[model samples]
Target: MADRDLRDCFLNTLHGKAVDKVPVLSVTQTGTVELMKKSGAAWPEAHFDAEKMADLALSAHTIAGLEAVRYPFCLTVLSEALGCRVNPGR
Candidate 1:
């Protein structure tokens, strides 16, 4: 399969549809301190900025060789919005 087909493979597999091959994907946040530094996308700010978040998410694929990109680096947005003090620890 072509490299570009990986995206469809990932999506099709996610929806339980058939594909030429199963794409290796991380459904969870694949970011690391290494990836953050390499991609120039750190936390705190990336957690709030949509563009930064998307860039960081895409870095998983571009930098870490992951087949897919995930979003919302941390799980604190909803909690924070709900008035909970979300300490996004470094």
Candidate 2:
């Protein structure tokens, strides 16, 4: 049902019809620890979790009325995912 709905929505747009609100995703690095600390979220990696990260990212859109969210806070993920050797804390 979701797939069909999405297809219909896309088709309608191709035919020049309006859809619902635009969804946006934004990514951020740094400041997570500070934000988490202020929000009283313990655990060092709570800054790395999706839900918490999304909550923090959504604040930009909420406060500034800009459509955006946060993603890929780790600068190392690209290197790591590509199988490069990364010594942590280097």
Candidate 3:
């Protein structure tokens, strides 16, 4: 095979477009107190406040190279929006 053809084939295999090799899965999730402790990140004082919560989340990705970052780390996000009080259970 030509070098160009081989390179394309390799790329396809890596992306699972071709079925030559079994693909390695890369997936992860958050929400572990131990992880925060290891990284020395402080939990938010008030999960009800959007800005403070965002800061706490950004610190995780910035410090540990997280794969993905999404909003409302606290479960109270929906409750807060619905005008319900969030205790945060800190």
Candidate 4:
């Protein structure tokens, strides 16, 4: 915990090591309508625009002080690439 970064905090938990305090992180996806409004990174657009997607991702940390950032906006990102039709759930 002494001068530990987020990676340290997360890795420590996975490895059964000690943390001074539990880091703020989500066990699930962090995207939500409230976060979209707060960060001005709504869906549909964020689904396609990397910058918008990044804004939404960072909101979890910037607004809630999470120790980590979740990178995927949708679970279907690779669906289209894998021969499935993907539609934006705006």
Per-residue CA lDDT of model 3 for 2-90, tens digit only, reads 43554565577767696443322223334346545654444664244556556556545554444335455655667888999776665
The deviation in Å at residue 74 for candidate 2 is 4.1
Off by over 4 Å in 3: 1-31, 34-41, 46-52
Clashing pairs in 4: none
lDDT of 4 by residue, 12-76 (tens): 98899997768877856888899999999988888788999999999998887788888786678
Lowest lDDT sum, 10 consecutive residues, model 3, at 20-29
Worst 10 residues of 1 by lDDT: 1-10
The CA lDDT at 66 in model 4 is: 84
For model 2 the TM-score comes to 0.40
Whichever of 1 and 3 has more lDDT, that candidate is 1
TM-score for each candidate, following the candidate numbering: 0.71, 0.40, 0.44, 0.81
Candidate 2 or 3, higher TM-score?
3
Candidate 2 per-residue C-alpha lDDT over 5-89 given as tens digits, one digit per residue, 9 for 90 to 100: 5556656666888877333334454334555465443233444576666655554444433343445455667898899976654
Report the Cα lDDT for residue 61, model 1.
84
The digit string of per-residue lDDT tens for model 1 on 1-90 reads: 555787778778989998776677676667788888988888877887887888789898888778877787666767987999976765
Among these predictions, the greatest lDDT belongs to 4
Better of 2 and 4 by lDDT: 4
| Pairs with backbone N, CA or C atoms under 3 Å apart (clashes), candidate 2 | 26-69, 26-70, 27-71
Q: Least accurate stretch of 10 residues (summed lDDT) in model 4?
A: 1-10
TM-score of 1: 0.71
Best-to-worst order by TM-score is 4, 1, 3, 2
